[model samples]
Target chain A: MIQVEHLTKKFGRIVAVDDISFRIKKGEIIGFLGPNGAGKSTTMNILTGCISASEGKALINGIDILEEPAKVKKMIGYLPENPPLYGEMTAKEFLHTVCDLKNIPKPVRKDEINRVMKRVGIVDVSGRLIRNLSKGYKQRVGLAQAMIGKPPIMILDEPTVGLDPGQIIGIRNLINDLGRDHTVILSSHILSEVQAVCERVMIIAKGKIIASDTPENLSQHLFGSNRLFVSVAAETAAVEKTVKSIPDIIEYQIEEGEEIGAVSVKMKAAENTDIRKAVFSAFAAANQPLLMMRPIDMSLEEIFLDLTSAEVEL
Target chain B: MIAVYKKELKSYFYTPGAYIFMGAFLLIAGLLFSLQNVFAGDSNYAGFLSSLIFIFLLVVPILTMKLFTEEKRQKTDILLLSSPVSIIGIVLGKYLAAVTVFAATLLITMLYPLFLSFHGRMDWAQIWGTYIGFFFLGSAFIAIGTFLSEVAESQTSAAILTFCGLLASWIIDYIISFVPTSSMAGAIFILILAGAAIAVFQSKAQDWRISAAAAVIAIAAVCILYIVTPDMLYGLISKFIAWFSLTSRFQRFSMGILKLDAVIYYLSFSAFFLYVTGSRIENRRWS
Candidate 1:
């Protein structure tokens, strides 16, 4: 529902968002993955019509944002890095003001505010001043602010930055629920959370988009080898020799195990190769017992580190 | 626009701003009312209202210190700017809310004339006329305060800067009498204004060619004006300062003569600053 062309943003001499373009489909939960200051928030700001791009254009539902900002902004619910809230007002009062700004009809404004408060689980504390609310509740209030008016697209910047574990899970679930109807474009530096919720992920680094793909596909396409970590109850040299003798094994490292008389080995096998059976037979023939063997896939964290650090070109 | 106005007006009451502003204004007005009209036997109620012009210089900054600057500090401007509302809507909404408070307080001070009504014959025309002039003048001051607050980073700085700005405008009328009235001084002043305009244009357009062309056009226009009427150039420096003296126009309404041109001038003054404030905020997205 959104398309950007050669979008660039300059804050004086520094180029905050370089010439980068991308499109987001309706109802797609796209995760903006990037490290700190990687133009994630800047891109979101431009997309929501909160800020203008120095070059090129942004279109929302085929309407140029610069030409029709009021219309485009109406279709977006933006939660900036810090939620724009009034501390002096209660959560309910704040939502009422937001409904006013969003032009929710008075007949349904109360019901709409109730729905959002319930969705974000802030209904109980709705009567309390926002300044007195905990950070997690305030964050939910921010989320509730964005979820009001039922805009087609919801852009949240770092939705889970300051929260306890349970609150994190709660917000993640809330976002997942929002994903059913709203096209959620949430930015976060946390890879695991993005992988858990996003159908597609875009990795940005240093004001440029380095990669974009599904979480599983990104990890698979960037990882060149499968690895195995095995702990054997045998002499270190024997474990090393047997692991080296396994077929399709490119390289292996053997280290003294934490347990006595055991050797731990980390071996790299060729891509798509399964060497567990061969290694089992080799150790069995050498009169050494296999204690533990597990295939290790490169996690998304490693993929994120690799992508952000320019380890591979996507 | 109404939504922003309602919310902004409501916020003033929700916080201590509205009461404090009203309280300070009434305290001073009451003290002046009793001291001059009641005790000093000064039957001129319009004169009492006239002397209260200095009240704006002291309290207007307090009224508008947090209008936009507080929004920036608390980051609530994101909500206002990112909404469907136009920049003009936000600007006008806040401006009108402040003007409403100012008008409301000015109405409360109407009790002073009512007191005079019981004790002496009153020139209702002159009283209301002066009230009208005072309202417009205060509205103009509030517009400047709103613009100052928008440009400043914090409420304290906005308040201080606004105070300085209003004080300067207040003092400009007095400052004009001491200025050189020579035609050469007028020419120099006009040229300096043109130069500053070109500098401002250059920064905004980022094109020296267009700015240079504008500078040339300004200089040419000034020269043409000088040649057409050399007499007008004499004392032009003081006249130029007088043009911005908001109180000088109010002095007429205080004399019970409602000049339409002065009304338009005051309204235009407020409108001009309000327009600049709107554009500055809109330009922030690009900056």
Candidate 2:
């Protein structure tokens, strides 16, 4: 339930967020993918009402943030790039303060705090000062702080930036868990994290949104041609001739295979075209046994690089 | 606002800030009280109360330096700003928290007056009046300290800046006496002030038309005053500076007289600075 229209933010002469527009439906988990300084944090900042946009507007549930910030901000739970924490306070005390800030009723404040602490898996460290906790625990506390009021929307900026791999998985699972009831918009440079956790990914580069789609669709759309990698027990020239004979195969490359008298072939066919049967029959006619065959799809990481790097070239 | 107030108040005690301020302030105030009253057998509590302002000037920085600068340095302001709380609410909450610590410490100092009352015939009117004045004056100073804290980037710098600001206000009365009293000088000073106000307004509003209109109106007002009544402009510089003399108004209070205007002056002074603090914070988000 968030909408941004032609939003732009300029810091003096430097534009931090160029003209950008996007909408997120209720309960949708959206990820902002970008390298550092790509306006990911800036956009999150604008959406959370932590900062003002220089032009255009952002709305939450049809309410403009600038027009009625208090009402709009009440609906959002934001975890900034740096977790906004007081070092001297314990994690429990910090959550209590957040509950107060969120206007959580006194009667239910403790229960809410406990629920959030357990949800973020920080119940063990609840009594410890936030400063003494490890990085992962501290981040969880930040997450818990955001989740205290159970707001409808959660905006996390690089939620798992400094965590260990296990912690990263923990946070990703936590986000996925949140997605069941909350609309989540998180930003990160880690492509696989977004691919694994988000229903949609928006690639932002140079203060502009370059691509927005589902993880699978992004890769499939970028690499329109279907690719097949095959290994055949035959001479390299024979495999190459057999592959070239397939009318549906638009491009082919034959290389010597690792095994003796074996050749590997890589080929691309038109979109939605299945050249597997044609290649099988041709290879069968040539009496070259097919050792292995598998379809190759571009990974999210590769698609991300291809898209973001293309922006740099422009 | 209550949430922010409680959190800030708790933070004050959680760190060494409140203790340091109260300890240093009480130690010095007690030393001064003992020297002026206990050993000398003097019952002139007003004199001791007046001297306590100097001690307040020193320790107030400790009470206020981390109010906002620490929040900025720690980046916790993001939490406050992103919450549903209004900017005014946040500023007022933090301001009241600092004032609460000051009020609590001032409450302890009541023992000094109580001891004097037990020994001699204390002027209750003068004592209570001075106490009220001292509270408001200290709050005004805290407001200044609060604004300085918001302006500086670090706690150390905020402390230094707040101390310097209080020091300037402390000596402003003395500085006022040496200023030129000639109408021409007053006219020139008023022009400079108007120019500075216009510059500040221009930076904040970014509307040249409003600045130009303000500049034109200020010049017109000054010219009319210069021509119609030069006498009104005589010694205007000192009078203008005296208007901001926070301590000068304490004379009425110390003499056992409660002037309504003086109380209002202290209150409005605090309100002015607090309002400016809120605006400064709001401006930061936009910038």
Candidate 3:
């Protein structure tokens, strides 16, 4: 539903967003993953028409954002990094104002406002001033504001940034529900949150998109080696030797354990290779009892660090 | 546009800005009304109204200081700009909201004239004319304030800059008297103005070609005017200053002479400033 081609944004001498191109299919929940100052917010700003791009074009459902901003902007509901809000106004009043600005039909505005407020779990605080609300509620109010018009496309920049764990889970569930119908694009520095909520992840660094793929695929592709941790009732050196004898074992590390006569060994296997049975048989031949053997699936945290740190190296 | 207008108007009251603006203006107007009309037994309400222009130097900044600056400070402009509304709509809505408050305050002051009407003979035409002029003049000032607010980074700076801008306009007549009236001085002044315009253009467009072309056109036009009517060059400095003399135009209205040209001039003046305000906002997105 959205196509950004050769998008570039420059602030005087500093290039905020380099030549970045990506396509977002309808109903796809895409995560913009990057550290602070990695052009994630800049890319979001350009896509939503909040700022002009120095070069290239953005299209929403075949409509050019720049050529016909009014028309294209109607289809998008954007929640900026700060959640543009009027502190003096109540949440209800703010949403009403947003409804009017979005040009929603008058008859449905009230119902739409109520529905959005309830959806974001801000219904009880609707009448209270936004300034008086807690940060989590304020963030929910911002989310409600973005969802008010029920626009087909929603661009939320760090929607769950300031929320508590419960609020974060609520917001994640809300985003998951939203992804069923709306084309959602959310940005965040939190890898687990993005992995939990987004179907596709775009890892951005240094104003460029380093990788974009499914969360599982990103973790797997970036972590090509399969790792297994094993604790054996044998000497450290003997355990290392036994694990290294496996045909596909790429590397192994042995460390002394706290328990008497016990040693812990970590084994690394080649890409997509399952060395579980091989290691079991090798230790069995050595007459070494295996205390524990567990495969380690690369966590999103490892993937994020590896990808971002790898970019730093490049 | 109407939504933005209503929301902005409500915001003034929701915050302390609207009440403060109204209270401050009424205090000044009440003091002037009592001193000039009630104490002196003068029935000329237009004079009092004319004198109240200086009050705008203080209250107008209060009314408009937060128009765009506060939005930016709060980051709420993102909501407004990302919506379907046009930038012109947003600017005009906010501008009209400020003017509406000014008009509401001006409406309350009509009771001062009602009291004069009960106590003495009143010139209804002159009072109406002065009120019209005051409305337009105040609207123009608000437009200037709106433009100033867009350019300033904070509410304090916007308020201070607006005060300085309005004060400059108020003192422009006094400043004009000290300017050199000789034709050579006028020629030099026009050249300096042209140079400033060229510099502004160069910085904005970042292109020497456009600035050079503009400079050439300006110089050529001035030369042609000098050769064609050398007499027009005489006292040109005063005339140039007079063009910006918004107060001078108000004089005709205060005299109960509602000149169409003056009305058009005031309106176009406000419109021009508002247009510049809109363009500045649009330019910010690109920069």
- Cα RMSD (angstroms) for every candidate in the order listed: 2.3, 2.8, 2.1
Q: Give the DockQ-based CAPRI class for model 3.
A: high
State the lDDT of candidate 1 residue by residue for B1-287, as single tens digits. 99899889988888888899999989988998899999987679999999999986799998999999879988999889788998999999999999999999998898889888998899999998999999999999999999999999999999999999999989998999999998777877899998988898888789988988888888888888788877888999899899889888999999998999999999999999999999998888879
What are the lDDT figures for the candidates, one per model? 0.90, 0.92, 0.90
lDDT of 1 by residue, A1-314 (tens): 88989999999999988899999999999999988989999999888887899998889999999999889888999999898888889999999999999899999998999999989999899999998999999999999998889999999999999999999999999899999999999999999999999999999887888899999888877764478788889887767777777789888888999889889888887777777788788889988987888877788888888777763354
TM-score of candidate 2 versus the correct structure, residues matched by position: 0.92
Q: Pairs clashing in candidate 2? A: none
- List, residue by residue over A51-120, the lDDT tens digit for candidate 3: 9999999999999899999999989989899989999999999999998898989999899998998888
Runs in model 1 deviating more than 4 A are A246-251, A311-314, B201-228
Candidate numbers, best DockQ first, in rank order:
3, 1, 2
True contacts kept of each: 0.93, 0.95, 0.93
TM-score of chain A of 1: 0.93
lDDT of 2 by residue, A1-314 (tens): 89999999999999999999999999999999999999999999999988899999998999999999999988999999999999999999999999989999999998999899889999888889998999999899999988988899999999998999999999999999999999999999998899999999999988999999999889878785488888999888777778878897888888888888888889999888877788789999999999999888888888878888988898
DockQ per model, Cα: 0.84, 0.80, 0.86
Error of 3 at B173 (Å): 0.3
Misplaced by over 4 Å in model 3 are A243-248, A258-261, B200-228
In candidate 3, position A157 carries an lDDT of 98
The TM-score of chain B in candidate 1 is 0.93
TM-score-best of 2 and 3: 3
